[model samples]
Target: MAAFDALPGAVRDGAVIVHFGSPLIEQRRLAAGEAVVPLTDRTLIEVAGEDRLTWLDSITSQSVARLRAGDSTELLVLDPQGRVEHAAAVFEDGASVWLIADEADAEKLAVWLQRMVFRSRVTVTVRSDAALAGFFAGGAAEARLTPSAPNGTPLIWRDPWHEVQPGGHQYAAVEGHPASDYAWSVAVVDDPAALTAPFAGALAAEALRIAAWRPRWSNEVDERTIPHESDWIRSAVHLSKGCYRGQETVAKVHNLGHPPRRLAALLLDGSDVVMPAQGDIVLAGDAEVGHVTSIAMHYEDGPIALAMLSRRAPVTELIVRTHEGVDIAAAQQVIVPADAGATAGVPRLTRLSRRPVAEDPRNAR
Candidate 1:
């Protein structure tokens, strides 16, 4: 509780400072250890009513109808033309569901869903005032935790990583009250203020995500972006789920054919590097094949990025050229789609060769 008193108002507004529950400062890579980051841009929406799950499943990429209370799913909602309009972490309680995303998209997504509810007996309310306190731990953790959001999203008390110890690795996203004196988590953490004092601009938090290889919705997804092209097939898609918007295209491209372009991890050359802004051209020798989506100077990996490139681009190291025509070091590594099997030992920075990416037929031309 004492921690909240020391934090700057910025972090207090959108997030709470919690402990790593262990002495993580001793680790060589502090970024890989626990740390606090601001979460001002994100929002939470509440969908309450008898028809919550069934109604949501009709529009989202995942089949929500099967989620038991306390269960959550990563979801994507596509526009009529098949472009992603909203990406969220959805969790269901007994009587409601919560959709968490950036504030700019929460109300719009909820409103869009509400309008589509003719007689489904559903009620969607945008909870723009709600904020999140989250940690992405990567070690061993218990499967069960308390529910914090109105939709009852879990409040994980242990590490989430499977191999890490009880306090090892876990990713927990919980709803918190406003930073006013009534804050909820202050009782548990000491020096909340000091911990949150460092979060200012979104850049610091973005840096953490970049180091974590987390692909953000704003910088990575859009109308022209296909699900597979953003690696949405990995964490966000549920292939076995029944129909939803854009399901046809998703299933066809994933199971029957390779996506025209594949997402890849780009290690930007940072020595004389010009950060490749979104839409900048990526090249292999003289051939223009792909474009950079999101990038940041990594604390450990130098400059790293996510991009979508022509799958036919010779699997080779290349340069990312800015719109201003500056050459930036761009190494390509395929973002294997969900249908691609046996990814156990794939290289993270694979060369873009003509060779089949894997033995899987999904990678076949």
Candidate 2:
């Protein structure tokens, strides 16, 4: 609270404050290009030395070997079986690569990166002094408040969720994807004090993200989560990239099979003025099908959530069982369909015809 005490009104959630007193109002202003938010829980990792990009590209999900200075993209470190381990927003300056990740995962990601630096000239260091802030409506203009990179461009990561990147593919089969409207970016600074503008809170930012159908590593991911399940291939995974740790699994699932589960966007019934908490059981009539991964109240959409449901679960109306034993009606918008994969378009063998009548009669005669 001390860090935000200077602000006129605020609300706290756990150790980090979630929003200012007027989150809906702040959300409106943020969408209107009038506000920015200091993402207090985001941290930075710096990778230096000439081998940084090549070394990173050899291990992660994205192809960063040719990532030019001032270019921005995100990468994922998947386990040997292709389960998501770590995700980061990545960019490079002339001398170093900067990774923006959840604060709770920064040190862990840094340690893993350091362990993989065998014989390579790369050096990994977590920059505790730096912080990340986000802006949506005027992200490019707001990014100007931060320090510039060697190329004279603001050190900002333009989010790639709005469109699929070079080696990426979209799993959402919708004609016009809702994520096309997600205009978001983040800027890193040595100190939050450099951002002199009044800011909104994390809640406001989260609401917008949910509405845009964007998935966060912290909220949407679980121990067994794979990129295919979250529709994350739209931004994180590179289908044509060369061998990485989990490349085999990624290739097989995307080309030959469907993910066991899929992500869904939910419109929650807000008649009771109650919201479902994370991990709330999502039910299809009397049977449990999945669990809510994230929920928020949007300025435009009254209440919305993102859930990872079994791919076999019917894509019809559902209900969310709150922690308090209350049932909240939920209408779903399919993000990833049950038949999401099989992108390779392999043909099936035809069955032989069973017309044996003429042949049998001739043989008998």
Each model's total of backbone clashes: 26, 0
Candidate 2: regions farther than 4 A off: 1-8, 137-144, 148-153, 347-365
For model 1, residues 179-287, the per-residue Cα lDDT tens digits are: 1111011001212332431232344344445543445677777557766665555456667677788877776665556566666778777887457788888888998
Model 2 sits at a Cα RMSD from the real structure of: 3.2
> 37-88 in candidate 2: lDDT tens per residue?
7777888899999999999999999989998888889999999999999999
lDDT of 2 at 299: 94
**Model 1: CA > 4 A from native:** 1-33, 138-201, 211-213, 337-365
TM-score of 1: 0.69
List TM-scores for all candidates, in order.
0.69, 0.92
